[model samples]
Structures are given as structure tokens and as C-alpha cells.
Target: MDWGSIFSNAMASALGPDAIVYALAAIGLNVHFGYTGLLNFGQAGFMAVAAYGLAASVATWGLPFWVGIAIGFGAALLLALLLGVPTLRLRADYLAIATIASAEILRLVFGSVTLSDWFGGSNGRQQFANTFYDMNPYSSRLDFGLFSFSANDAWVFTVGWFLVALSCLAVWSLMRSPWGRVLKSIREDEDAVRSLGKNVFSYKMQALILGGMFGALAGFMLAIKQQSVIPTDYATDITFFAYTALLLGGAGRVLGPVIGAIIFWFLMTFLGGFFSSAASIDLIPDVVMSDIQASLVRFILVGAGLMALMIFRPQGIFGDRREIAIDGR
Candidate 1:
């Protein structure tokens, strides 16, 4: 029951590469649901396609890593268009249904035996990340007193955080521009924006593309960090978690996702460690809860916290309540 180890693990997760990845994903969702009032439940689909695009291009087609990156982003752009073209003009819920269903379809397709040759079924692909690692400058691991990371992890962290920063800056800048104003206006009332002679449909499409591209970048981070890509990694739950992080940090605010990701992972790992350590000390009877059950109980607690947040503080930690008052109509 070493509390130090547990605390270190939790702290690492708070600022780790995984948190950066989720932050990036939530940033994309912020653009859709936060700023533009788009209900894109298939963000995981965008991530999955981008990851597979990169893996298949480099591993199967023998393309360069950079080219694979381009292909992956291209796939994400295509997906956004395909999804938005048919559904954006309809009610918001239609887009939600379409996105969620499309994401599930993609997960199944990638894991299906019929496409095992290209996607490798459920095992996914590796060996494509050598090019990324070959460029790493650090020769040894980074030893920070509380936590340490391999050279590879250090390099990924550098790139991942840089991307997160760049994305946030972009969102901030965009939201201040005329285009950003139109997006916000649409979120509040599409009819009003249309009455002003603005192209609501086109604006929605653009938001979808921009947000999906961000999600695609997140896909790259997740894939490059682990040096592998799996279908299960892009499940529907990932999107839900991103939404949670978005809500936690304060949606419609540029930096909400970043803060939310840190807090969410911190709480998750922190509670996990405390529960596991308590179990080891035999403080609780087995009849109360076993070690395995402790692992899941943390999520239950976090879920309850989220419910409380929704009930008492729906605007989140940094979000202004009015910012989220956009009319879905």
C-alpha cells in the first residue's frame, strides 16, 4: 500500500500524454457542440478512420510516415463531408444519430475478419512508428522526481502538448473572428443567421470539417504515442468521455477541455489508487467490495460527480452559464 506510488501515478496522468490526447479530442467537440451547437456523436469515427488511414497507408501501401499523415487527415476531412452533407441540414438529433451509428459501423468494419488483411482485424498495426521514434533527440529517459518517462514518451509529450497548445490558440483566434461570430450566432439561432443572409448549411459544414480535423490530429497522437492503433480504442465510450471532459472544464470556453482532461484523469487515477491501496490494507471486508470491484467503483463515483455537476453547475468550472444557452433550434 505505497501511497507515494499511487500519488505519483495519479499526478502523471493529470499531465501525461494520454490527457493531452483527450484534451485535443474534446477541443474538437467544443467546436461542434460548444460553439456551433452541432451534435456530433461520431467523433470517435473520425479518430478511427484517421488512425486506420495512417496505419494502412504506411504498413500496407508502404507510404512515408508524413504521407500517411496527409492521408489520415484527408480521410477525416472526407468523413466530415460525408457525414455533414446528408445530416447537417436536418434536425440536430439526426446528426447525432447518424454520427453515433456511423462510428459504431466503423469500429465493427475495422475489427471485422473481412478486412483483416488491411486492418489486421482486432490486433491492429505496429512498426509504422519507427520513423517517428527515429527522429527523437533524447538518448535517455526523463527523470522528474515523482514520475519518469522514456525518451519516446518524452518526444511524444513534446509534440502532443505543442499540438494541444496550437489547437487552443487556433480556437481562441477563430472564435474572435467574424467567421467565429457567425458560428456562435448559428448555435443560438440558425434562422436568425439565415435571415441575415448567411449560409447556415455551409457554416455547419465548415465547423464539422474543422472539428473533425482536430479529432484526426488526436487520432495521430494516440496512435503515435502507443505506436499502434486498435479498433477498440476508438469505441463510442471515448466520445462520451471526451464530452464529459468538455462539460467538466466548461464547454464553449477555449481552454475548458484542457482543464477538464487534467481534472478527469487526475480524479480517475487518484481514486483508483486510493481504492486499490485501501483494499490491499484489508480495511474493507471482501463482502463489501473486492479489489477488482474497487477498480470500477471509481468510475461510479466520477459518474456521480458528473451528475452532480450537471445538476448544480452545468456551466462547468470556467464556463459562463449563458455561453451554453444557445438555442438548438
Candidate 2:
């Protein structure tokens, strides 16, 4: 097996656009599940709407790129209001059910034949990100020792990392404020916070809107990086994966999502590269594992790793045990 190649690929993935995308999404999830205890399982829905918002605004309506961005953010804000108002007052589990269901519903609607004219149905939308790429400052590929990036990818990396940094700073600042303290207190016990004459519903809505905006940022990153917005790309698994990243990094902590995203992508890429290389060399018997099967082993291993983490260290690398204790009431 080519160990050097595998290691390089893993390194590249650790810092690539995929890591940035998940990091932003996980940061949003951390705000919801980690800090506020919101149980927002529809994060993918937020991302989808924002992505489609931008795609439709530019590709279908011939709007400017910046206008598309504003529309995407607006769409995310609308989604948060729509989801939070109806279910934030209910039990956390209800919020979870509502979010997950709504995410799936939105995905189906975006892909529906009836909406093809606007959303491109199952095919999705492209040709909407040229404006973003046209602003690239890097005229040539950026070559690092371990991996290299095309000029386009280099521009994305710069923008994506900047966004991640800005989001982290915002979360850090917010969590240290009085409002942030209340959110933590509410997470520990909403009834107690409510007894203090605080408007729990209002705070919850604010957190939802803030977190959904972060999700929208992630959506923008993805749409720009891929130069397309496909409904299928916003599946429920996307939200779960972001959750996994948040859990791995430790929820409620500002840097947890970012760290978790880097590690998650590193491990995933390393395992994938290792398996693919081994299979190419027939290190494992064909009957035991084919090239196709090699690609799947990484997910199985990661899943088992996640289960172990939940069992042995539910608080994650940087999370406190108390942070995971949600006040379901």
C-alpha cells in the first residue's frame, strides 16, 4: 500500500472544503443541541433552503450573487421562525421529530417534478456560482508539501476558513455574555430559568435563528465549493454527520465542532485511503473484501468508534458531562 499517498490524502481531506462545510454545520448544531438544548434535527433543512435559495435566486431569477446570498440568509431565517414557533414550546423530542420530518419534507419538495422549473427537481441547480469563482485571487494552484489545491479550491479554502473563524468568534463571544449564560442555565433546567421570570420561548427562538444562520453559512460554503445545489445532497444524513462532528468535538464548546470536523475528516480519509490501497494490492482476499466493500469499511469503523465514544466518553473531547444532560422538560 502507498502509505505516503494515503497520509497525504488524509491530510488534504482534513483541511479541505468538506471539513469546512461540516465544521460550520456542526458549529450550528453545537449552538442548538450543545448550548441551548434545542434538539434541532432539521439543520439539513436549513442548509438546503439556503443553498436552493441562492441557486434559484441566481440561476432561475437572474439575480446578482450578493443578492442570492441575502436571499439564502433570509430563507434560513424564515425556516427558523417557521420551525421554532410551532414546536419550540413542546417537548424536546417533539422538536426533534418536527425538525427531522420537516427536513425530509423540504428535500422532497425541492426535488419534486412540480418545482423543477425553479429548483431543477432532482437534477439540482448549477451555473450559479461563477460569480463567486470570478473573485478568486489565487491565479495558480497552491502547492503544499502534503497536498495541493487548485486556484479555485484555494479561494474556497480561504473564504471557508475565514467564515469558520468568524463563526467561532461569534459563538465564543455570545457564550460568554449574560444571554449566553441564560442559555446554558436553560439547558440545565428550563423550569428553573422560567421561574426566574425569563422568557424561555424567546431565548429559544433566538438560538434557533442564530444556529440556523450558521447552517446557512455552511450551505453557502457547500454551494460555492461544489458550484451546484442538489436536493439529494441535503439528505438527513448530512444533519446526522454534523451531529457526529459536534459530538466528537464536544458540544457546547466553541472550538469543539471545528476540531471534531478536522479529526473526523482525517480519520475518514485515512481509513478510506488505507482500505482502497490495500484492496488495490489484494492485501485482503477478493472474496473477503472487494474494492467496493473497501470503500464501506471506513463508515462501519467510524460508526463503531462513535458508539464507543458515546459509551465511554459521552461528553466528547472537549465537552463537559453536564453539558450533555438536557432538561427535557
Candidate 3:
């Protein structure tokens, strides 16, 4: 097995665009599920709206890049409002069902034949990110012996990390304020917060909007990194993956999602590389596992690993046990 190549691939994936995208998405999930105790299972919906918002505005309507950015953010905000107003007052499970359903609905709508002209349907949209790439300063690939990134990827890497840093700072600062304390209180017990004459519904809505905005940022990064937007990209698994990252890192803490994202992708890529290499070298019998099966072994191992983590440390690496306790009332 090529251990050197395995390590290199792991390192690259740990710091790659995929990690950045999930980190941002997990951060947004932290705001909703961590700080505010929201059961938003449709985070991918928010991402989709923003991604297609940018893709349609630029690739279809011939708008400037900045306008697309505004539209994406606006769409996220609107989604938050639409989802929150109808479900926040209900039980937490209702919100979860609504969110997950809404996301799937949006995905299907975007991929529908009727909307192909505007959204490009299942084929998706491209040619919308030229303006974004035009500002790249890296001019050449950044090869650091073990791993490398193309000039365009290098640009996204820089901006993505910056956004991660900025998001963490904002979460840290907000969680220290009185408002942030209220959110924690709500997470612990909404009835107690309501007894204090605080408007619980309003706070929930604000958190939803804030978290949705973060999801939108992740969408923008994902869209610009690929310079395309496809409806299938915002599938239900995206939200689950973000949740997994959030849980692994320790939710309710400011930097938990960021660290979790790094570790999650690192382990996933490392295991995949190891299995692929082993299979290629005939270390395992073909009767036991094929090259195709080797690729999927990572998911099984990771799932089992996550199960172990939940059984042993449900709060995650950096999360407090009390933090995961949500107030269903």
C-alpha cells in the first residue's frame, strides 16, 4: 500500500473545499440545533435556495455576481421566515418534519422539467462563477510536496477558511451576550424562558434566520467552488452529513463544528485511501471484497465509529452533556 499517497490524500481532504463547505454547514447547524435547540432537518433546502439563487440570477438572467449574492442571501432569509413562522410555535418534531419535507420539495422543484429554463433542471447551471474566479490572486497551483491545489481552488480555500473564521468569531461573540444566554436558556427550557416574559417564538425565528444565513454562505462557497449548481447536490444526505460533522465536533460550542469537519473529512479520506490501496495491492481476497466494495467500506466504518461515539460520548469531543438536552416543549 502507498502510505505516503494515503497520508497525502487525507491531508488534502482535511483542508480541501469539501471540508470547508461542511464546516460552514455544520456551523449553521450549530446555531440552530446547538445554541437554539431548533430541529431544522431541511438545512439543505436553505443551501439549495441560495445556490440556485446565485446560479439563476447570473447564468439565466445575466445579472452581476453581486446581485446573485444578494439574491441568495435574500432567498435564505425568506426560507427561514417561511419555515419558522408556520412551525416554530408547534412541537419541535413538527419543525423537523417540515424542514426535511421542504428541502426535498425544493430539490424536486428545481429539478423539475418545468423549471429547467430557469434552474437548468437536473443538468444544473454553470458559467455563473467567472466573475468570482476572475479575482483569484494565486496565478498558479500551490504545491506543498505532500498535497496541492489549483489556483482557483486555492482562491476558494482562502476565502472559505476566512468565512469559517468569521463565522466562529460571530458565534463566539454572540454566545457571550445576554441574547445568547437567552438562546441557551431556550434550548434548555422554553417554558422557563417564556415565564420570564421573553418572546420564545421570536427568538427561535431569529436563530433560524441567522443559522439559515450561515447555510446560505456554505451554499455560496459550494456553488462558487464548482462554478455550478445542481439540484441533486442539495440532497437530504447533505443535511445529515452536516449534522454528523456538528455532532462529532461537539455542538453548542463555538469551534466544535469547525474541528469536527476537519476530523470527519480526514478520517473519511484516510480510510478510503487505505482501503483502496490495500485492495489494489491484493492485500484482501477478491472473494471477500472488490475494488467497488472497498470504496464503500469507509462509510460502514465511519457509521460504526459514530455509533460508538454516541454510545460513549453523546455530547461530542467538545460538547457538554447538558448542551445536547433539548426542550421539546
lDDT of each: 0.92, 0.93, 0.93
All candidates in order of lDDT, best leading: 2, 3, 1
lDDT of 1 by residue, 1-329 (tens): 78898989998888888898899999999999999999999989999999899998998789999999999999999999999999999999999999999999999999999998998899988778789999999889977899988899989888888999999999999999999999999988999999999999999999999999999988998888998988999999999999999999999999999999999999989999888778767876678889788777889999999999998888999987664464322
- Provide the TM-score for each candidate, comma-separated: 0.97, 0.97, 0.97
RMSD of each: 1.7, 1.9, 2.0
190-302, model 3: which lDDT tens digit per residue? 99999999999999999999999999999999999999898889999999989999999998989999999999999999999888778878887788898779978999998
Which regions of candidate 3 deviate over 4 angstroms? 321-329
Pairs of residues clashing in candidate 3: none
| Model 3 score (lDDT) | 0.93
The digit string of per-residue lDDT tens for model 2 on 1-329 reads 78998999898899999999999999999999999999999999999999999999999999999999999999999999999999999989999999999999999999999999999999999989999999999999999978999899999999999999999999999999999999988888899999999999999999999999999999999998989988889999999989999999999899999999999999999999888778878997788989889978999999999999998888899977764575322
Give the lowest summed-lDDT range of ten residues in model 2: 320-329
| Candidate 2 off by > 4 Å | 321-329
* Model 1: how far residue 293 lies from native, Å: 0.9
Where does candidate 2 clash, by residue pair? none
